[model samples]
Target: MPTQQEIELQAAAFRRLQKHLMEDRTDVQNIDMMNLAGFCRNCLSRWYAEAAAEKGIEIGKEEARELFYGMSMQEWKATYQTEATDDQQKAFKTAFKENVGQE
Candidate 1:
């Protein structure tokens, strides 16, 4: 098991990664992320929700998304999301299945 300090460090690293994705790299679309990295902002938000659940905290998906995004999902999409290309979508399906298992 990790020490308390290790847990804090991991949290700090996660926050930095969130900032990098949310603030510094707005041009990187979620679909493209899933295609290449098999994860995206949505996946991160879902993981956040799951983590809260493990702690006996009941966080709904949208609420977790809002908390992680610092805004509503609709707002984030309107502001930064782009439509995916056909090939990107195809790649995303394979990546999603491989990484996330099923739809």
Candidate 2:
């Protein structure tokens, strides 16, 4: 098991990554991220929810999403999300199956 300091360091790194994605890189679309990297903001939010569950904190999906995005999902979509290109959409199908199949 990791020491308290190690866990804190990991948590700090996660916060930095979250800020980078949610605050610094709004241009990066979730669909594109899913297509290219097999995960996205939504995935991160879900992971957050899962983590909270593990800790017996009971955070729901929307709540987790709001915490991660620093805003509602709809607001983020309105402000930053764009239409995916045909190629991106196609790639998403394969990527989704490979990365998060049937989940």
Candidate 3:
């Protein structure tokens, strides 16, 4: 088990990553991220929702997305999202299968 301080440090790092992705790097598209990193903002939000379920706190997907993105998904899509190319979509399918498996 990790120490309390270590857990706090990890939490801080996670916050930094979230801020970096959500605010500092809005130019990064989710499909590109998923294709490259095998995870994207949607994946993070889904993980958050799963964690909440583990803690007995109910949160829907859109709610989790809003919390993670700091806005409605529709708003975020309108403002920052771009259409993915066919190549990106193909890569994303492979990455998602490799990293996330079937669910």
Candidate 4:
């Protein structure tokens, strides 16, 4: 079991990572991230929702995304998202299947 201090440190690390992704690296395309890392901001948001579910808290996908993004999906897309190239899309399909399974 993790001690309380460890939990706090982990939480802090998560927050820093979230900020790095959401604020510092807005230029990083989700498809590129998915292809390269097997996960992306959307995956993070989904994981956040899943965690909430485990705690008996209900959080829908869009809501969780908004919480993690600090903005609506549409706004984020308009502001930061870029169109994925064909290769990126193809790689993303494989990566998503491997990392997240079928949906």
Candidate 5:
């Protein structure tokens, strides 16, 4: 097991990452993020929901998405996400396969 301080540090890092993701939607394209960073906001939301499930806390997918996106995921998609280009789509498939890890 990690030491308490290590866990806290990781938690703080996660919060910082989540905050950045929530606020900087325009600076990061979801497809490019998936391709380069190995995950996107949707993936983060899913992981959040999975973590809740592990503790018998049932967080709905929409709720999880809202937590990550700072809005309903549908709203975020309609407002910010653009159609992926062919190269982006192809890269995302490869990257997702590599990085999805479990969820």
Candidate 6:
């Protein structure tokens, strides 16, 4: 089992990464991010919702998405996202095949 301190440190690092994704990479499309990182903002939001459910907390998908996106998800889409090109879509399929169920 992991030590409490290690878990805390890991949680802190995850927070930093989440903040960077939310604040610094606002222009990066989630599809591109998933292609590169194997997980996108929506994946994070889903995991957040799952965690809440595990703890008997009721958080809707939209609530989790807003928490991760730092705005309404639709607002984020309208403001910073572009439709993925064919190449991006292809790369995403490859990435998902390589990364599925690893997290």
Of models 1 and 4, which has the larger TM-score? Answer: 4
- Model 3, 1-103: lDDT tens digits are 9999999999899899999999999999999998888899999999999999999999999999999999999999999999888899889889989988975
CA deviation > 4 Å runs, candidate 2: none
**Model 2 Cα lDDT, one tens digit per residue, 1-103:** 9999999999999999999998898898898899878999888999999998999999988999999999998999899999888999889889888987874
Cα distance off (Å), candidate 3, residue 34: 0.7
Off by over 4 Å in 6: 93-103
lDDT of 4 by residue, 1-103 (tens): 9999999999999999999999999999998888988899999999999999999999999999999999999999999998888888789889999999996
lDDT of 2: 0.91
Question: The CA-based lDDT of model 6 is what?
Answer: 0.87
- TM-score, candidate 2, is 0.92
Candidate 1 local lDDT, residue 18: 96
Per-residue lDDT tens digits of candidate 5, residues 1-103?
9999999999899998888877754668888988988888889899999999999999998999988778887888888778889999989888888988633
TM-score of every model versus the real structure: 0.94, 0.92, 0.92, 0.97, 0.80, 0.80
RMSD (Cα, Å) for all candidates, in order, is: 0.9, 1.2, 1.3, 0.6, 2.5, 3.0
Q: Which residue pairs collide, candidate 5?
A: none
The per-model lDDT (C-alpha) reads: 0.93, 0.91, 0.94, 0.95, 0.85, 0.87
RMSD of 1: 0.9
Estimate, for each residue in 31-99, the C-alpha lDDT of model 1 and write its tens digit.
988888889998999999999999999999999999999999999999998888889888988999998
Q: List runs of model 1 lying over 4 Å from the truth.
A: none
| lDDT string, candidate 6, 1-103, tens digits | 9999999998899899898888887778889888888988888898989999999999998999998788998898888889889999988888877875533
Q: List the residue pairs that clash in candidate 6.
A: none
